[model samples]
Target chain A: MKILFPIILYLVVSLLLLAPCALCQDEVSGCVNCHSELDDGDIEAPTELFKNDIHNQAALGCVGCHGGDPTSDDEDLAMSEATGFIGVPDPTDIPKICSKCHSDPVFMKSFDPGLAIDQYAKYMTSIHGIRNSAGDTKVAQCASCHRAHDIRKANDPKSSTYAFNLPGTCAACHANNVYMAGYDIATDQHTDYERSVHGIALLEKRDIGAPACNDCHGNHGAVPPEVGSIDKVCGLCHANNMTNFDQSTHNEYFDALEMPACETCHSNHYVDSPSTDILDGETSVCAQCHNSDESPEGLEAADGMRKSIDSLNTSLTVVKEKLDESDRKGLFVTNALFTWQEARQKEFAAKTAVHTFDLGKVTGVTAEGLELASQADVAADDLLAGYVFRRAGLAVSVFFLGLLALLLWLKARQIDARQQSL
Target chain B: MIDRRSFLDWLLGGTVFAGLAAILYPAARYLEPQEIPEAAISSLKVGTIEDFPLDSGTIFKFGRKPGLLIHDADGKFRAFHATCTHLSCVVQYRKDMGAIYCACHNGRFDINGKNISGPPPRPLEEFDVHLKGNEVYVSLRG
Candidate 1:
């Protein structure tokens, strides 16, 4: 009784201790074990790659996405339709699958409390989402931008949705003309975006703050901005210019004409650095809509604003030239540099103020700028004049000192002669 | 006493002093820090309560930048940085709109300085409005 009772007690205690661990074993799934032993690369790749997946790290297994029996060792049982095994879900069903867990605040919060749960809700509003709902299989889904098995956090550099990689990820579907054949939209957006000011800043300069494909056109709720809201989209970063434009006379006129406020002047997707030539030169954007015959007032305003900007620019150039000259000559021009910086700031304000379309308002800012530039020019002039004065004084001192030395030399010669006679 | 040697020594000494002064005078001026103005505007007495009527807002200069002060419909005073978060344009209070408006992008902020609409990515920076004997003063928030 003693030997049998001790053995039974030992077995019962061992089972009691290890039963919870067995029940709680998330990694005990049959899917990966069998999938890893597959002869086919296509069937086996996911098992190997998913070992390092973010979902795996979070303790989610194939059953979480594919939905099958995880504990069963029989291949037929694990892959059986009766167990709800859905192998290779359709693209249209991808959002539903992802949002099942992602859309639930309580479920998402358990993993990441701060993670946004609105993506699925916002995705429904997007063109892609609307198309996907209509049974269009080619449109982007959750797995398109974020890969199926190798998903990582958006902030991860290796993530497909990382700011730097997002462009290429979007381009994968968007850049293919054949893939986008039925759509009315152009496929040139990706290539055009690559050469744009925003793209250069983000792609080449690696400035994450620079807007990517998702900034203007939202990521989940992507849409082309309306004509009226184009300025608002651009103004998200170009706040000062938007401020001037929103209050300008052209705001109502453009709204009535259905002309995009910013895209009319700054081309969408391929915006280049705006030069003053766009205002007064042969390639004037204002001249496109305005003429000396019909829209005389607009052309006049453009001319006046252009001339005001030009005047300040010319004065600034002159002042800068003078400052540079002083610096080159090794003159102390700190005060002048400070004055130049203030003047340059005013010039920038004036340029932004041009959106006001008020000639007087632009000239008012430019007038202040011109005055500051004149002051800087005067300072630079003084620096140059002081240099000249110092040089002249030096010449005069050298001449006088040379004359004194000659006199001293002659006196010494006379003294030597007198000493020899003695 | 009036020898050439002494005269030469005096000349050399004057030349050396002039050279040293030329070098050291500018250096001293360069090294000497400019007297700093109030390093930052932590606090300012913007105006009296009477200056801003009920349900009124105004932009007041706070040092180099501008600040917006509002007297809400509830008769409470609120102050915030007037600059728009998107493009740094000075925001204005539209009486008809009853919200702080950035004319640049139609960005709107509530009386509480929260960004409500348009393109601004951040809310307006709020300040503490202190009332002392009918005088309204704006101070940086703790």
Candidate 2:
């Protein structure tokens, strides 16, 4: 009887504590509950699936959008009673749902009035949206990338779209062997990307210039780009290189002879490790297009760039050796070359620069190679000065001390002789 | 007659004065009165708190610097600098993506001013914000 009283008292206190929350519960249901089941075909609905979302936890509820009786417990009445009950929306209807909040200039202006309101229109024009509109249900929808619930900030590491985590998210579909096998799509893109230069740059060196999945693929309306479009996209950042490549003998030859341009030498997609070694200058990319019996122009153009790259590499080697010797001799050296220790740094810049045919930048950077050589020479001069002055000082001091010792011994002998004579 | 001790003192004093003049000449050139005004420390009224929609961001220009005022879905107000940490590019808020994105280098920042992606070296700095009556006051230091 005594224990029963305490249990009843505990229940009463708990209920009293829960009363405010229960009263406020009506303002906390999902927008889907009321708006998702209407007969309106145009209304794209996400359903009450977002009830467990963080938005709901913040007291955002169903009546906030799809007006309904929140207090009603009856399922049939809850479905029938809501004012703006829209039917279950298809993938094509996602844009309408997204645009409801996004398109309202007044609503968005409160947050970012200047925010772009054209995402829905842009998506419609995108390849992914077009394919999805045609009823390719397997295509990624808004919820696929953005997530239906648990939607956090994109900057959140836990968010699906964060750079480091995006590869894994993309792999969700791309790595699915069964899904890929149907379309003959190789599942090795994620693996291959992990090993590519961009992959190594991003994953190992944390270079942001290294392209991620979306760098090549569109963020919202992703699709496979045409082979011809790759250079134009890649050229956005590599302007100098792209310009040189277009003007190079290869591009000229291709334009005149009606052959493929730079991609002929640099294959698309599966780019291999580009080596700048003089002895190993001959590349398979050049050999494929040039060495063939039909086109001698490809062979000649490849040889010219190959020679320039070789000379640059040789100059760098000489500079590096001399710089190392200077460092060993205890001279401090500072320059762009000394700062960029990895050979790949200059090689990447030089190789791309050569393709652009910007002889000025090519010459300027290549001149830095000669300048590094001069820095080595200056370091050597300083070393010689140190050695000469230090040795001369030591020799003079030793000679003077020897002469003084001889003079002192002679005086002592003279004093002894004088004493004997007396 | 002038004593040797007095003559030595005069010599030492002359040397010291010369040394002080030499050092101060270059330092005086380097030192200049600051011309730029310090950022306002007191909170300035932005707008009514009710004007900020839930789970949205509003960009406002305070002085010469651009700032983003974000009202989270929970009705909590936050302010972040619009400048990028990497290259000082202006960042825009993508509400659907829920990130402050820099288009220059694809830099991304969370609503809480954390660097999520791209080449930014540090998180975006946040401005202090408070609500008084119906208006929102943002601190320059914040």
Candidate 3:
């Protein structure tokens, strides 16, 4: 009985040690069990918030990120330095901690084969990364946008880094007057972008293809597009307009002045659709730079281009109306209508040619349109003339037929009277 | 004997030829390169020492192309063709960056005209710089 009592005490002690290990093997570790029972808000908050986290949903436990032993139920044993328990990482060390698994291509591929592993490398090149490396803890780190405990995929609509939500997410830090006061950045970019053409397309129209904050400024390696590269950024959409601008003499002139290419005229945040008003008169973008007193020849060229475009548009309208009138009169003005359509196409070509900023090119295209419009007008006039000739010919034929009928009636009456007298 | 139709055709053709020559002659003359008397000077004097402040760069015309002259912070002068090696764009001295900067592509070059960063593939072509009694002279190197 004494030997049995000693054996029973040994068995109870061994089972107490083995019970936590058995619980750790069941997926809910000793760390979660102890933390769930804690009354501290700091300890309980992460446990509760982590329930819906992407990492938690993927079955990655707290020890995967926090770096502690999950099997031990004793607080000292689990949180000991010997077990590699690094508590909350500092702001400067956060990026490196995230990159441990993110930068590993093999690890990232296990979850998503196509996921890029260069985010850490690109983050090192960003202004935030550069400043952070220089020991500025105020700069944005991994947890700034991708919330630490509850990060979602960038494609998820609820994600702070999602395309549609990025503007508001950026504005959280950027628009805060007290937060951005130390940095010399203008906080109006978010407000300006919301009203711009790109902003309207993305926000109001819900166009997924329209660009947001990360489109012009890159995602991980976010930086202001350099003065020389502004055209290249805008050219991703306005390719043909950029091609025309790049090939013009203005490209060399602007480059000589060290000017931002596309932003100099169209602006960066508030780029509106271009119109003929940008080429001429008091409100002209050209007139803003070139006046008759300063650049007489340049002013003359701009004026000539505007006049040519206006003339071509007027001629097209007049010819189209005349062709429509002939069609309404039951005249087959198909050939005239075809010529008028060609004129309209030429007018569009002339407007695109104005980007060359060359009067000769604009006038050359406008001249072709003018010639086609005149030809169409002539065809419509001929159709109307032919209609009038046919009407006159029909009236004359009717008058001659009436005369013949009268003469025949008189002859018949004379023959009847002669028969009665006999 | 020439017929009347042939005589009229010759007259019309000659008139058209005269009209075309009248229009093309002015255009050809307009396109022709004009002689600049100032470009004849081979060793052009850019400016005096006082005109170029310490740690400053000035662009001067070397015949038709632009030439860049930099008076570095240490009071040493260097000269090179202003054109960028990548796209022939005019490069300027950025006091903030303390390097020769080509705004066209964000290309940079060291004081000695070595291509350092960005898209520039080759060094800027160096020019012979001579200082004679505070007068800076730049000329194409032989």
Candidate 4:
């Protein structure tokens, strides 16, 4: 009786240890099977679309969100409200539903510990959240951007919030005049953004590092930048340019005049690449604020900055052309090419330095660039001269060798004649 | 006074020798082992535990790049790569904010090296911090 009791106790302990392993295995939900069999498109569609959801991939069942008796095979009993089943949750309740699992550190740690938990808190401050809470059904909710049954990780290429796809996802409602008719904002943002430098880089070049719709406009707490905050928003990427702009004389004037710093010159969505041409003439960005009669000093500074950039740009172009010419001749202009690259960086620095609005600061960088360009120009010239010298030396060697060959031929003929005579 | 046969033979021998030397010299160098610098140090003794006061941060050179070693207010030693994820600009620990801050763009990273705010798309890479007695050592995390 004692031996039997010990064996029974051992078996019971072993069963307790193995129980978690059995339950931890991928669970097959009976609800999906029953829903899949249903003739109703609304019922069957979730089961089909859920196959691709991030939750489904993580082995979470339909009961994870829409709770029901996942254990039962009977259709009516399985979906009973007694088990806390809630189907087709309202838009307002979706955030709460998502945050229940997402915001739990202990629960989320098993999946992704690095994922931020404050998305719901941030969303509450957004315009969409405020409008949605006010009983407006038209505004976006958690399910609006991230589809209910087919939500994916933001990094997934197929995700609605992926860097390349995000602009288009936002444009679905934003670009439609009918949908956005109630809003006071212009609907041309998506169109303008599509043609912008950032858009071209992200969508065409597939550069994920480039800013998307969410980079400037917050992903959850999205709002338009006010007049005072425009420079701060633009400064995130162009840190040096922002630093210079902050110290510029125009900063206080722009603040007093209520002009947006970077956007005033570089336009917000449709920022085109700037050139020296923008510094002067009828199309000058400065002309919008400064006139020739009233602010002649402003015009003078702008003109000087333009000439400084042009001078350095012209020198870089000429040096680059020389390097290309030398390279084509197969003169091995590696040094000259490297010098030109350094000069190119200096030119870029000078361009960014123009935000200081000081002629001296801009010229300081440009002067260093001009020196590098001059060095490259000299190196290319040396290579060309060396090529010419090598060509002349080759001609000299060929003439003497030809003369030697002729003499050898004559001497061989003379030896043949003497042998024949002997 | 030299005959054509003898002169041609001499020239042929010199040309073949020159060609052989040119080919064999480069081949020998290619096969030979180059004296490269020693392998990168896997673990570095940053300093003694006493060198780092509570909540104080210090920067040290790790190989060619910079590394940030912080003695947090929690009394744990942690280290991270000092470069910002947004740009390649070097980052500094902002004691005031109690976070790794990049002044270049105001990018902020939490103690766990997770990017909290600003333009950083990715997190700063973290290194393993080991304490052997009073000596603190930082090493690459496996």
The numbered model that scores best in TM-score is: 4
Q: Model 2, residue A340: what's the lDDT?
A: 25
Error of 3 at A346 (Å): 6.6
Clashing pairs in 4: none
Q: At residue B83, what lDDT does model 2 achieve?
A: 75
Model 1 misplaced regions, further than 4 Å: A1-30, A36-39, A48-52, A324-331, A391-410, B1-142
Scored by lDDT, the top model is 1
| DockQ, candidate no. 4 | 0.10
- List the candidate numbers ranked by TM-score, top first: 4, 1, 2, 3
Candidate 3 global Cα RMSD: 22.8
Off by over 4 Å in 2: A1-26, A29-92, A252-274, A277-282, A292-297, A321-349, A356-368, A375-422, B1-142
DockQ scores of the candidates: 0.10, 0.03, 0.01, 0.10
Model 3, span A124-235: residue lDDT tens: 9999899887888888888898888778889888888887888888888887888889899988888888888778867786655567888888888989999888888876
* Per-residue alpha-carbon lDDT of candidate 3 for residues B46-138, written as tens digits (9 for 90 to 100): 999899998889987665467799999999989998888865667888788789987544678998999887656689999888999989888
DockQ of 1: 0.10
lDDT of 1 at A333: 67
lDDT of 1 by residue, A31-85 (tens): 7777888899998889877866788777777887787787887778887999898
**Which is the winner by TM-score between candidate 2 and candidate 4?**
4
Candidate with the greatest DockQ versus the true structure: 4
Q: What is the lDDT of residue A19 in candidate 2?
A: 82
Model 2 CAPRI rating: incorrect
- lDDT of each residue in A253-275, candidate 4, tens digit only: 99999998999998998887568
